[model samples]
Target: MRSVNNHCDLYDFSIWGNEDVSSGKGAKDENFPVGSLLISRKLRPHVQAYYNFARVIDDIADSEMLSSEEKVKRLNGMQAVLCDDVPAPDRADVQAARYLRNSLLETGVSFDTATDLLIAFRQDAVKNRYETFAELLEYCRYSANPVGHYLLDLHKENADIRPAADALCTSLQILNHLQDCRADLIRLDRCYIPLDMLRAENVDVQAVKDEGTISGLRNVFDYILDYIDDLNREAEQLIRLTSNRRLRMESSVILTLACSLTEHLRKEDPLATRVKLNYKDAIKAVLYACPHILR
Candidate 1:
């Protein structure tokens, strides 16, 4: 294994070439707010650093250009840089890891919160189907839960609030899965909907490729939405549990956004079109979160 400080030669790009597969998406493009105005200005840089690292790895995992082995290798390389097991290569993704490494050091947050995301992205490189909802939530434990944990840690919030934070993060992850169901199937051949649920609904996995959601798929969507509703309810506790005023407001807004998006997913056919919160929904989120800020 190469030492983290081994600054031998720059990493060779010939192995994968210098082509960038980044989706060119950033935090602002996400469905939920990220390091938004609600976050303290002092801490936004750390949040943005984390977001950039996550976005890079997600693109790597989702890339059609890379083979499964190559994707895993790349993700591992990024992780190596993050853990300071090896110096970052002259690449954007690895540089992202280095940036986040600095952020983790500055914030006194656990590096595990960042490393845990790699476990999920690595799984994404190889696993495409979920056997059950339990399996999917297990995936979220690594993929989504760390995000909330990072924020809570940054704000010096109580660890007891983690369950609510996990609930909210997992809810957002599933909502994204539902919204991108068709595109994921077509582009990456990945499916987040549990296989058991599809089997129970008598819906084939390929059904998502249809021009519109079939009745069976819609039923499955509704089932998932019902579960998300429960998660949103559970996540509601985060607002009260968070002692920091800004974090409380941020949690309240995110919970409201999750609930609004859940309702939109229930009514809209994702296969037919993407379901998203509108400006009115944003307004409502702010209105709902305002009381938390005042309190």
Candidate 2:
């Protein structure tokens, strides 16, 4: 098993695209999400590449200022470009786009799966609000769950564990959106707080965008908090279905981070402050995953 894992790790490494890492932002941003993966020197490289791809797409969607139609067009074209089915266009930002293209070739990640990722981001660019929780889950299925599913495919084990991982990843993503509600709303014009919940709270959609200081803001937060709690509980049940030590530790680390975020949110006003973890707490999470390194 060790030999097989080592070989897989090598293949994974070859697939990792060399990019500018001087900012150290990637490590810092994933402080909560992929702590367990970082703890192990043996985690697959392609897994890291996949993360980079997601990061690039998400950052482009969230941080950049492209027109909505242009953003969707570039994202929709990504699959063909990555697969060498299309030539590099002048409009695409070559550096980031090249990294994705090369990483796709090195990892043999299929165009279909890669397209799913792009489509998710494209949806993010234009689709600001979800109509229902079920609609949100479908969004999660596209945006968040694919990362976990793709990683499982790379490992060639834990196919059975994916349903649970799917749930957990979706929960984590939703948790992030909730935690960053004010930030996302103010900066990105995106709101994950469902429209139905807004109606229940009597918060006008324009009010959320303009003032964000309505009775409905607090009520919406409370309602979403309840949903996040329920998802975490379901995730806890799913984590028990996996026996793989690395996977368990990884899941535990994510759960702990989610729990920490959830707990912190519960104690403080998320609208008033951004919750952040210090390096010490991060080190502790990494250390907590140490015992499972061998698996």
The most accurate candidate by lDDT is 1
Per-residue C-alpha lDDT of model 2 across residues 1-295, encoded as one tens digit per residue? 0011122222232222232212224845663664334434545555555666666667656744566765554454444445443444433232355565566566555545555677688889899888787888888888888776765554454567777777777877887776677778778778877888788877765555543345667777766667777777777754565565666677767766666677666666666666565666666666766665665
Clashes of each: 2, 0
- Give stretches of model 2 more than 4 Å off: 1-25, 31-43, 89-112, 206-215, 278-295
Candidates in order: C-alpha RMSD to true structure: 2.6, 8.3
Clashing pairs in 2: none
Could you tell me which 10 consecutive residues in candidate 1 have the lowest summed lDDT?
1-10
TM-score of each: 0.94, 0.77
Candidate 2 Cα deviation (angstroms), residue 100? 4.7
Q: Over all chains combined, what TM-score does candidate 2 have?
A: 0.77
Task: Provide the overall lDDT of each model, using Cα atoms, as 2-decimal numbers.
Answer: 0.88, 0.62
Candidate 2, residue 180: the lDDT equals: 75
**Candidate 2: residue 168 lDDT (0-100):** 74
lDDT of 2 at 122: 82
State the lDDT at 252 in candidate 2.
67
